[model samples]
Target: MIPSSLRARFTIIAACAITVALVLAGFMLTLIFDGNIRARAVAEVGDDLRTLAANARIGPDGRLVIDGDLSDPRFRTPYGGYYWQAGRDQQIDLKSRSLLDFTIDWRPQPPTGNDVAIYERPAPEGRRMFVLERRVVVSRGGTPTIARIVVGLDQGELDEARTAFIQFAASSLAALGFALVAALWFATSASLAPLRALRAALMEVHLGRKTSVEGRFPDEVKPLVDDLNALLQARNADLVTARARAGDLAHGLKTPLAVLTSTARQLREAGQAEAAADIEGEVQRMSRHVTRELVRARAGVRAFRRSHPTPIAPVAATLTRALSALPSPRPIAFETRIPAEAAAPMDETDLTEVMGNVVDNARKWARGKVLITATEAAGAIHIAVEDDGPGLPGDALSYEIERGRRLDEQVEGSGFGLAIVKDLVEAYGGDLTLTRSPLGGLKVDIVLP
Candidate 1:
């Protein structure tokens, strides 16, 4: 039986795989969003650098200065949160009051060398600064003088915002994973429900309580169920035919045996001992022949029964008991090395008859032992019978097995055993081979579909 927890394992694996993919996708989206936010911040700082450079002036001695307050209300507000510095000839000319009398300590770096550079430095108020710098050439006193503009943005707020976004994304991803696991559990159960129903239906058939399976199965499994049901129907029809044959054979032979018994009794009462003895002897032989024919006929019927799925163990056991009742039974050793529940599409009674006849024949010539064994291979069932008896003559064996031939003409019994085996085996879509046994006797190997 397969484990029930297998569904849970599958669900966990699927959910984990989906969650991992989604989390990676979500992280990539977060990185793209962070990049967009940083791009907008850089653009805003570039605009501020342009406006600050436009307000610069030059003294008569070529000292660069700012002519106005150069302090927008935006600079004083923490919401603006920006720092600016202007330098001419490498000397600070103007700075943001937000720097609070603290000069921006940015190195006068040429912006053309690198598009952007970020660094942490000490601010005017000794606060930590993340500063961005750019160099601008301004026309002062009609001469081009180089002025460097530095812009600083607060790092604490940006760091806090990024951390909050990461926390939110992590929590959302965790929730999505939990939900995915739950959904997977429900989906798996729903998908497998039909298989469970099919299992229960099969179990019912196994118990002999149902003759056919019926259900609305998924498209993938419908064909399997249909084939199984068709096989069951065919088996039931075969069983009906078998029962009819058995009944017909009994009805046909009972009257003749009764007449023979009555005739023998009448001869004895008339004081004709010699005639009575001869009649009785013939009657006994006739009776034996009738019985053997009935057995053979019944075996044919059984072969049809076994064309359905029939377990081998019980059939083998039944044969052993039935064959034990034979008058001249030898030490017939019946060995079955098959699973107790191993089954095939074979009639139990047919299997029994096949084994019984072969074993009985071995017992006739076996010195001490008759062996019967059954096994399965390559989707077929194989039964082999052997004995430690005088083996059949090679030429005689071949001649006897020929169709419609009888070998034991004077053997005071019906010589139809092998013939019947051959017919019945063929009817069941199987083959029977007669060969010399390793035990020094005839070996019969039967292969059945």
Candidate 2:
């Protein structure tokens, strides 16, 4: 597909319009010049014919004769592309030597008082001739005899002149079109510089390098930049307020839950053992819910808005040590195959929260061994957590990773670990998938950009 960028579209449209305009202008110019040259040729031939008619006389033998010299020398050269002829009573009388036996072949028509008639006629060697013809009356002894006089000039020179004009015009117009396209390209790039700057600012905002759009812009784009900055400011302020409220709510509930625990202890001491157990279970469930909400609050809008490069290897190593220290009935081996240079593109706190939950869950389910490995490729980080326990069935893989979905409720878990990891990964333009592991257990693969 052709990229739908503004520059490409504008260049195509402007180039088409300019090419069409130049072609039409060149065609019209050539046409007008050809017409004017043809008109001038007819007028010159008419003038020469008038001069020839004025020099004619009726000789005593009733034949036509010329009085004196016609100024043009081509009248004497045979086939010189110029000629003259005269006739009386449909019989040829006098003619120019240049005709060389090639007849003008013009039919004379009587003209109004001083008007001349001109037409194109055939001449020698297949050349075209512009002929001017007229009928004249000569008187002898007060009696008049009508005679026809004609003059012609070859049209080859005019055709050559028109061809040369067309060639020159075509070259000039092509040069002009090229220059116009070049100027348009330069002007278009310069005009869109502000937009390019705006795009760069947006990229920086996405990468958490800048808080808002910044820099000078044209009047046309300044308002847009202002609106985007306003949106970012509002978003950041709202996230801060929401997180503060969540923190306050969690602290408030913690105090009440602690008092409840103290009361349950007193009941157990007073011999109401069953009631104390039930109360403690309810309180623990409530506490877990509160902790889940706190995690959600931490993974707030700012989780994605404020990004910082966090090294994955160090965080994974720290998590490995913490998980290994936990007491388990079976000795569990923890393996960390992460490079020191591996980094994820997200805030450090968010990455810690997300990876912690995932690694802890793997430790809980793995029977003999758990593996945490991370690698960097293409502009993204890939982290996988695998375990050697009974993996989930293929039929349950799609929905089992969702929140509050535990295959066995007998297991002590709220089932929010994978869900939280998925949510946090997507928030930072990443994805998480669950699949069967080579270690005969579940594999959690995450890609963070």
Candidate 3:
């Protein structure tokens, strides 16, 4: 599988380029070595041809002959790899013993006066040969003639050396390519280190550990850092402005609402019962809307961004104690089974409000016992409140708790409290659930992370 990381992609590209470079370099180097080796072989053959020329002459019988023994011993060895021949008018007059009557495959061609002609022979005896030939004037015993002299050498030694060189070059290049690819991987890693650091800094900012992303970054990454910081500042400013506006709206409308309440009361005392009823109903509706908006405004996610963790045990105990004091037809017992370390990641006030509403709701319906238990696990807080009273049916569990709407008018509660709790829990990145309790009553479960 291809890696999704930028570093891996860069390494792959670099490896391909290195492989291509190695292939081209190997081809060029092999060509250069072959040319040099062939040139040296040609020079050696030319020297041998010159030696044969200096020693050759036309004998008294008009036949080509040598004045003395050849310097190279291979010239006398039968069927040896080295051989030479001398002839006039395409007729052989003298030859090396190495030929063994297996004549040189010489092709006739016009020649330059002094320049030697050298070329590779076609395959013979399942091996290649290099031939150097020249037409030269020689005289001995008062006889002169133009003789064609040719020297040939087997190419097996040069072929073996070239093969060995190719093997060595291929292995060396393979090792080099590996090293270069590895170096590229490390280089890419080092270059991306700054990006890793920047990501960590952003995480810290998100967790509220720091207000803005901070730390040293590469020049190429500083612009992003600066932009993030500016965004954070702008967000904080917007939150402040929004909070002030909510507060202002609440304060600005307080006097008018108070006056309306006062006028309704006055009308009620003056026998305008229908008018008072209408005014009171409108006022109540306005009051519910204002209260819901206030709760929502305070529970904004950004508003609680810097909130400290609030322990749940103390809050549970306090609410239990306060609720136990209320008079009832039967004495109710409250059990708070929360650990000291169980804390919710929200403000103390908001946590108190959320737990208070849930606990109170449970207390109202509990027959004789209310159980409160909370735990902290894996950076999350889970709270369960169970009551022993008659719980709602499965269909009733979907209680659409909205502002100014009560599920049952017989119940002496606004029903908006749980709605506020739900909003508050969600604002802090948490969730609330209603389920059948093991205690045979309703269970309110909340998890906050």
Q: What does candidate 1's lDDT look like per residue over 175-226, in tens digits?
A: 8888888888889999888888998997666544466787789999899999
| TM-score of candidate 2 to 2 decimals | 0.80
How does candidate 3 score on lDDT?
Answer: 0.81
Each candidate: what lDDT? 0.70, 0.82, 0.81
lDDT of 3 at 260: 96
Residue-wise lDDT of candidate 3 within 157-223, one digit each (tens)?
6898899999999999999999999988988999999999989997777566788888999899999
- For residue 159, model 3's alpha carbon misses the true position, in angstroms, by 4.9
Identify the leading candidate in terms of lDDT.
2
Query: On residues 165-186, what C-alpha lDDT tens digit does candidate 2 reach at each position?
Result: 9999999999999999899999
Candidate 2's clash total is 0
Preferred candidate (TM-score higher): 2 or 3: 2
By TM-score, who's the top model here?
2
Q: How high a TM-score does candidate 1 get?
A: 0.48
User: What local lDDT does model 1 show for residue 337?
Assistant: 66
